[model samples]
Target chain A: MTTKTPEQINEDLLRPLEGTSPRYLAALTFFVLVVLAGAAAFLHQVYAGLGVTGLNRPVFWGFYITDFVFWIGLSHAGTLISAILRLSNATWRRPVTRCAEVITVFALSIGAMFPVVHLGRPWLAFWLFPYPSERGIWPNIRSPLLWDFFAINTYLLGSVTFLVLPILPDMALVRDRTTGWKKKLYHVLSLGWTGTPRQWSRLEMAMRIMAVAVIPVAVSVHSIVSWDFAMAPVPGWHSTIFAPYFVCGAIFSGIAALIIAMALLRKFLHLEDYLLRIHFENLGKLLLVMSLLWFYFVFAERLTTWYGNGSSEMAVFWPTQSGSYAPLFWAMVVCNFVIPFPILAIKKLRTIAGTVVASIGVVIGMWLERFLIIVPSLSHKYLPYSYGSYRPSFTEIIITVATFAGLAMLYMLFSKIIPIISVWELKAGEVTETATAPALARPEQVRAD
Target chain B: MASVNSIYGLFADPDAADRGVNALRHAGVAQDQIVVMSSEPHEGHAFSLLDHKTIMPWLAALGGVVGGACGFLLARYTQVAYPEPLITGGMPLVAPFPSAIVTYELTMMGAVITTVVTLLITARLLKWKQPLYDSEISYGKILVGVLGPSGAARTDLENRLRSAGAEKIKTTGQL
Candidate 1:
């Protein structure tokens, strides 16, 4: 990657928004079709009832719950990790933070939809809130479901703030450079930022406070998500280790998703200079650590369950170990640990291609892990007569596929509106070390927008 | 807010901007009267007034306290205050563990929401017009605007800016 002047950087970053291409329109059309298909499937499920899903008595929860967990875990990719890196003074985070922060906001929004989608009466989802109505009742505050409701919404709000606050200056820059409707929209989004000292000061302070404050909220979110299963009395579901295990898995999957998003943005947006090989190398190392930690967690969990030797637990466990779920079980292991461990553990193979491949595997593997955690236990319960199998119906399958498409669509649209790579931050990074250099002194070289 | 006559200087050099700030101070411009506008945050620069003190920490704390209290009360009152208690598995109505979970989440919500609100107000955002704004700052120029300058002081400040390598000086929003 080569160093770029602020002018070149501005031109490169803004190039995506200069005009829409036929290819972009085609891609957007494809994603919109998928979203519409998912909406249609959801309508079918709603009209026909939850019976339209593959949900059965023993295996009541299936793909939707897994997707909820998966999307929620993916949300961890951005804001939490970016916040941590920012607070730790990780300078390399500059190019990556905006991309990651955007993921958090979108993924959280997508993830929060599952609970509603899975509900028998999606319209009554508001009952989850603490609002007292004519029925004169509040939501059960003791339930972990309510806890998740509060946690996810709070996280969504904070993530949006975290994502939008730093982008204000960039938006103002865009506002100054653009014309017509887009310029008008930028005016509102930029919040009248003029790069004044006090504005930047308070913005930085607010970001700091949010950065410090959002960590525990992020941590608690996944933990509470874990508690959704852990609080249950079912054999495999009830575990004290669920909180940390789920949190680790979330961050693990989150980093993988971020790497994938970065790679995609790099290729499509022509940000080769900005999103450099060094970024992939560093994030690959982080992903490698997370992979090891994830392996430790899985090993510890299985070992404890095996040693405890409770019949109910073993009944839930054996299928995952050597029974029906063994294939998905091992596939998950390969995708998450076996494949990624070697690829990421070695430096030469940790190239952009290598990391992307590992990330793809991790994404698939994490989805499987969520599925395996939810379904198998629910399937092979202690009561042998009640033991049942699940295969997702067309409705569930279509909607699940659509949600993935929805995410892709949302991300693509977002990049078109705002530069996927933050322009100002990248420019700042260039001048940070050489602020007094003659190159900076001659700001007249900067192109007039 | 008291209306003050604004004198603006545009510089290409960060060092020039720094020196220009000093000259303004020498010319009797108060620290609060001077504003530095740039495309990037200059956190440690002497001219970077953005490193000024903020009350975000205290506000976050206050918000957390209030939010946590609400969380606790919401949990307690919802479970115990109803005409009929909603209990699970014969457990106590107002379980401390369950209550603490919601308390922790809502407390964080309070802190973040408070921090965001404080940020908006203190940053003086959403205003129709901002003081001393110029499109040139977006094009990599650094702006130093001193408010409340008189005829002679303004000219002296402009001359000081000229010596410090300002590309141009203007009072009517020209960069």
Candidate 2:
């Protein structure tokens, strides 16, 4: 096959989103309003101290911390799918990398803010930094909290770098295609790229380095986040398996978020041809593998705790399985483990609709999983007399809604600015095919003749 | 040293430059007598025809060891220097679990940073004075280089490249 003309490729890549449908616009407006409301509530919390939220003495971290973990966990999908897949040369990752990376950048920003939000004195949160303050004390490096500061910062920098590097070539393409301020913006961002052999080699090399580099950072970041809880002396929290458990769960929820993102972008951007059914099928396979792994971790964790039958561990386990939070606990198991196992297991049901449904279940189940991890331990501390149930207030709910809205808004804005799919990588793949196909086809031609 | 009798040079797209080197070997060029030079670093697989091997992975491994050591020091030495006099349940002041966290973080950070730095150094990047091939190669092309006898050998190499779908060919000075 002859190479498609640049004009045809440009048309294929930049087909304008069918002007935002009324329903879509209305939904977006509603989310924006909800986000504003949440922001207002957050402002109230900041002004009035965390006192405005339902977080009390025992339940110092409630929705905000859970959301923090959730958001950070969501960030893993991009690096995992994009960088990891790229290194392995998984061609299927081509369509999903941009959205995944964008989700990562946004999710990291959002997740990074929660620690600040959780701080009672938000203004004094700078105290976490290891600077010479009015107090002569440095942050205790021994503390997991301090480790979180390093881990999150490293993760954020790595994720941002990972996101921006690949986008440079795509930005150049966008600059070439568009006009007016967007073109100027793209031009300024594209760094005077002329597609020289040296530049391409360097670019590809940088991308390869980044892809290989980001995977471990991504894994370690979430593992450290899990350590924030697990390293605590609290009985239920002091499990060695927490690291892998958290990592698997992060990947699970991250993939689910990616699925939802792909579906939305596919619908909104009309990217069905580029992000085809096969991509979804591949993602479904990943989800199934992760689902089984997550289930295994969960089972191993429970069986160990149950077999040990330690009083404090059992105390936490009982509430999780059959006590006050049993409904949430069981629902988490069904959603995260049970539902995904079968739906993703069957090949016939691993289509777009099935994967999407399974993804939704995963998102819900993972959220519930966070809730299960958090509330149970806090509700069952060593001294039984001190343990108490946590109930989140309306303010907390509003802020949660706002944070999600903010994430969506950031994603929407990103799409409008840069392509949701990497135009350059797609083009590069196309060019590779064009370059190689003639050589590949000659044997066939000779055979045919 | 024997007077360098021949100034050998050839230009190619990166892929052709790569394949040309291998073809050079088949055409009776020795590993030491030939060099592949290009506008950028080509794949190591292409350099299999050469005498010197790439040193990137060795540097990466060294970085990993240093990083893991640093992590160990961070995890183990904290208690030693500060002396947390109070002990909890006789757990060693330097816990293995938390130490593993540090080890993992530092090891990965080291490996990644080293890999990046090695690539940059090997590719000879960020130098303002480096020469370049045509800009179009950046738009999805490759460049290959071979150094040997300039006249007949270069022509034969050019013919080989053209047959392999190389769009253009040129020769430069000694390197």
Candidate 3:
């Protein structure tokens, strides 16, 4: 570990915020264009109605729902992992926590957009909320979709707080360093932080509370998301095992996303020195564990279904195993398990680049997993004649691509606005290290006299 | 003792700041009157004035309870308010399971929001008027703020800070 002087740390952390390079502008323009294209496609879908996307009988939910589940699963990357690591007192998490938390906020925001997008009358999405209306009937409270609303909104609120709170001191730092409009903006964001003892105390206390509180919220969010499927009467969808299974998959996918994000940031932001090898190795180990756990869950879920021998469920299962969706299913297994296992498990190949490679596969695999899960079961619902395949239309593909571009663009924007690294937290880590080292060296130093 | 005076001493080294804070205390500066501001949080330092009491714990709990209550009301009222309450899947009118989901989410949301608000109020954030501050704090300097002692003690405080290796010391009128 490098011991950085406060001046060195300040300069390093604030480098990204100094000025936008030409490359940043170019990347931003590309993403913006992608976003615009996506918006146009979505508008086309709206103008043409839900028919633009392939929503035939028995397979109403398709790519949009898959994207919804994928992005929401990705949202688990930040708050839950960060909260867990923070509560556990992991020293290595200082450089990582903010990045992870940003993912949660943005992914949740993007994921929440889908339910509306998928709703045929998209503008009337507010009907989902419990409100007094001309229609005498309320939206069903017994529905898991309603549960999803409450859980996701709660998680988003917690995530926003979790992301913004630690940023105050750093905002104050920027407020002091800059002049003109940027300074004015930062001044308001910093909230008059004078760094008094009380400020630090309250900050630490709030962080601890958030760290503890957000974990359950994070867990509930994915569980509720899983319940969206499990609560249904459809064969493959209704199972008691779905909650933990989905939560595990969510974390599994979430960590892979975080790793990929960190690697990209390390390269583009030139944070190679700070976001070191150790961080990747540590995260790679985590990915490996999740991979193993994921393999186990997949095994358990599949084994139980195959053993039960229920023809209705078997119809849904066969497509994923050796039938129509078999290719995608096997690809998911390879990506989530096969590709990641050796690369992450073996220390030699678990370099930054190696982990990124594995993460790429995992991302693809997890997305395929969602696609397989939603499409196959929806296609093979009880009636044989109703059983039909679904394919994503051009509009759905365009919008899905746009969401990825949007995520990149948002992250770029956030990086420019603030120090993405938690500068104060890193310094705090250093301070604690130095502060505690002396006591360990000289036990008699504890004397009050 | 002519009048109460406020002073700031800047140090590049954290240990020097620590000693300076102790020196001010020995010179009869009350613990609450001595404020140490650093670019980072330095734990386990002998800076008693940095101690602060917070009501955030109570505030957050209160927020959670309120959120839980609101959640229950929203779920219940929506169900009952419907003039034509359609029974879906023959489930009861007010299902506790689904209501609990809303309640749990709202409870957590309330706690997080309340804690953040409490942090804002306690830290006195976003105020138009800036407080006494040093730009060097951002450049990794430790600043010791000595508030409201007489001129003689302020002079003694200045000497103490200077002797403890302060790079610069600035004295101002009473804050």
Candidate 4:
């Protein structure tokens, strides 16, 4: 219920884009250097062949594939959540939608790079495309990997359009307010937006359709990623529950990522008033729900696997439960469930700091979840003689770390170029709030409700 | 491009803009001649209802159909047309289920891309010539104006907008 004029909102939101601090530069430079190091490692790997990494006969899909799934799951943070919130007409979503959508685009882009990074022959990666080639062979349309190529590409395109549609007016606002090359740049970016009623109406309509259209695309993207494992007939991965489990875990981790990103933006960008306690409380409740859902999926997957007692499945199950991978398994449980469950479930403990703690745990836990799902199952495949354990080499580790840094750097640079918060959406919300119930616009009234 | 004449007035509030629209309409401005613009959508207001019923949804559906066909054919024809079709994962060469996934993704992409293109075309965005424009629209002001009104009609429209509580009135051509 913190009321702000459109002018104040614009000034506050646009302030971050106007200038750079030494801290921002230092952070960007650090991220870029880390990314460059990752690139160097990737080059080394490409030159040295896939043997430089941890891949063996059995555990070929190791850190890179795990990173791929984790990042793609993390990408569910933005477009899916934002679309749902917009469709649901969540009033608190005004300040959150843009940041959330930005995460999806960046995270998805980074996630999509892993398949290329992990390729034995990176140059031959274009074979994944559907084009007719000189070799006279088309990619197998039936492969889950091909489905992934289509799904991720579609989601990325859909997400970019989703993010760009709402940014037009904000760009126009910047175009009008600034001068020189910045103005020229924003003018081109804005595409001659005049904010005519027709334009606004059409934009709103398009957003509505996108919100509806993108949810399934997002769902299908993660599900296809899961199928990449499930279709393999590996002991633990070949399950009917893998698709929904991955999708739920995706939203779970995605929400956690969103919370952490929002917290950082609030602290660093001075969006304290805009990203309020109520927003955190609401998102914390969502995190709690997803955490429970994630736990349920894990329990259901395990309970059925353990009860069925198929020797092949148990081969993968025992190591994850009480054998070599037990520590990581229990840690994943603690991070994804035990620690977050109570913090998020308790109202008093679900403050910004509390949620951030829980979110960090979930982020780590989800990464572990992806790792456990890929590695343990591969290591314990039914053939005992072919059993192998994978440990990531320096190259894999550096590239993995680089992807995280790359996402942060992209987000940082994007914030500088575009208003992190949607200015006009806030204004629109304010107008609606003032018009519908002026009395409810009071801070005390809003708090009591 | 020739400089088309336009007269516009900026109003601080939407109600005033609505009133300005009403005044212009009362002063015999054609429905198509009147143009209203604002930074945010003012749905349910008369100003926002200008040609509001659009063919965007239909066109998007058509795009989806076209994309679906292209995707289906791309998957089926490409696999079949290959001199030696490789049956993957024990599935048929022309796998319906997998083809459906490709079709679904392409259909959504087609719809999304078409929606944006339709919005741009229907909203008349990216025009090289700036039609009636005022920077104040970005400052939470509503612009009410007439595009290509006759020289004799310019004074009448400006007077109506001014009397209807326009904070500022502007002209882009000789009046």
Per-model TM values vs. the true structure:
0.95, 0.77, 0.94, 0.96
Candidate 4 clashes between residue pairs 3 or more apart in a chain or in different chains: none
Model 4: which docking level applies? acceptable
By DockQ thresholds, what CAPRI class is model 3? medium
Number of the predicted model whose DockQ against the real structure is largest: 3
The DockQ figures for the candidates are: 0.44, 0.10, 0.50, 0.45
lDDT of 3 by residue, B19-49 (tens): 7776676666666677678767666654423
Off by over 4 Å in 3: A1-3, A133-137, A432-449, B1-5
Q: Write the per-residue lDDT of candidate 3 for residues A242-333, one digit (tens) a residue.
A: 88988998998899999999999999998986798999899999999999998999999999999999999999999899988898899999
Estimate every model's Cα lDDT from 0 to 1.
0.87, 0.71, 0.86, 0.89
Q: Please give, for residues A172-221, the per-residue lDDT of candidate 4 as tens digits.
A: 99999999999899988998898887888889889998898899999999
Best by lDDT: 4
Q: Chain A TM-scores, all candidates?
A: 0.96, 0.93, 0.96, 0.96
Candidate 2 per-residue lDDT, tens place, A364-393, comes to: 998888878887788788888888889999
lDDT of 1 by residue, A1-449 (tens): 33577888889999998888898999999999999999999998888899989899989899999999999999999999999998998989999999998889998999999999999899989889898676667888778899999999889989999998988999999988998998889989898998876787788788889899889989999999999999988889899999999999999999999999999999988888888899999999999999999999999999999999999999988999899999999999999999999999999999999999999999999999999999998997788889899999999889999988998999999998888887777776666544442222112222221
Error of 2 at B11 (Å): 16
What order do you get sorting by DockQ, best first? 3, 4, 1, 2
Model 4, runs deviating above 4 Å: A433-449
| Residues forming the 10-long window of minimal summed lDDT in candidate 1 chain B | B42-51
